[model samples]
Target: MKATWNGVTLAESDDTVVVEGNHYFPESSLKREYVSFSNHRTSCAWKGQAHYYSLFVNGEMNPDAVWYYPEPSEAAAQIKGRVAFWKGVKVEE
Candidate 1:
């Protein structure tokens, strides 16, 4: 899968974990130059706390458009530190 926004590829990986229809790109596959942590968070009863990231690319800023499970619950352990995109970011094959 490829995660893209603002005409930039944020991450691409052959191996992805899908939960709730969101493809979680491996943390290692992220393009760090275009990514940074955001002071945003959310909780999922089964997935644990989610940390957010801002994607900056081509003079565009997508705030908290990416999220990951830094310390996922047991049921969501597979996505620990893996990222997923939303808010107009595209994830496609």
Candidate 2:
């Protein structure tokens, strides 16, 4: 799968975890230079807490567009350390 935004390929990996209809890319697949920590968080009952990341590419900023569960509940352990994107970011096979 590949994660693209503004025509930029931000991440791509053959190995991705799908959970709750979202494809979670492995941390190793991300373009770290285009990512920065975001002070945003949301919680899911089964997934636990999710932390967010802001994406920047070609001078464009996509705030809180990426999220991941650093420490997920047992039910969602498979997605731990994997990231998902939204808000106009496209994930394609």
Candidate 3:
């Protein structure tokens, strides 16, 4: 899968974990240069707390567009070390 926003590729990986209809890409697959810190956070009853990352690509900012569970619950362990995109970011094959 490939994740893209603002006409830029945020991440691409053949190996992705699908949970709750989102494709979680490997952390290493992300193009870090286009990512920035986001203080935003959300919690999932079964997934634990999710941290966020905003996207900055081609002079546009997509705040809190990426999220991942730093320490997912055992039920969601498969998503560890992975990131998922949203807030208008497209994930496709």
The per-candidate count of clashes, in order, stands at 0, 0, 0
Winner on TM-score (2 vs 3) = 3
- What lDDT does each candidate get? 0.93, 0.93, 0.94
The lDDT of model 3 is 0.94
Q: Candidate 3 residues 1-93, lDDT tens each? A: 899898888999999999989999999999999999999999898899999999999888989999999999999999999999999999998
TM-scores of all candidate predictions against the true structure = 0.97, 0.97, 0.98
Model 1: per-residue Cα lDDT at residue 46? 92
CA lDDT for candidate 2: 0.93
User: lDDT winner among the candidates?
Assistant: 3
Pick out the ten consecutive residues of candidate 2 with the lowest summed lDDT: 74-83
Q: Candidate 1's C-alpha lDDT?
A: 0.93
Candidate 3 contains a number of clashing pairs equal to 0
Task: Give a tens-digit lDDT track for model 1, residues 1-93.
Answer: 999998999899999999999999999999999987799999999999999999889998889999998889998999987999999999999
Model 1 pairs in collision:
none
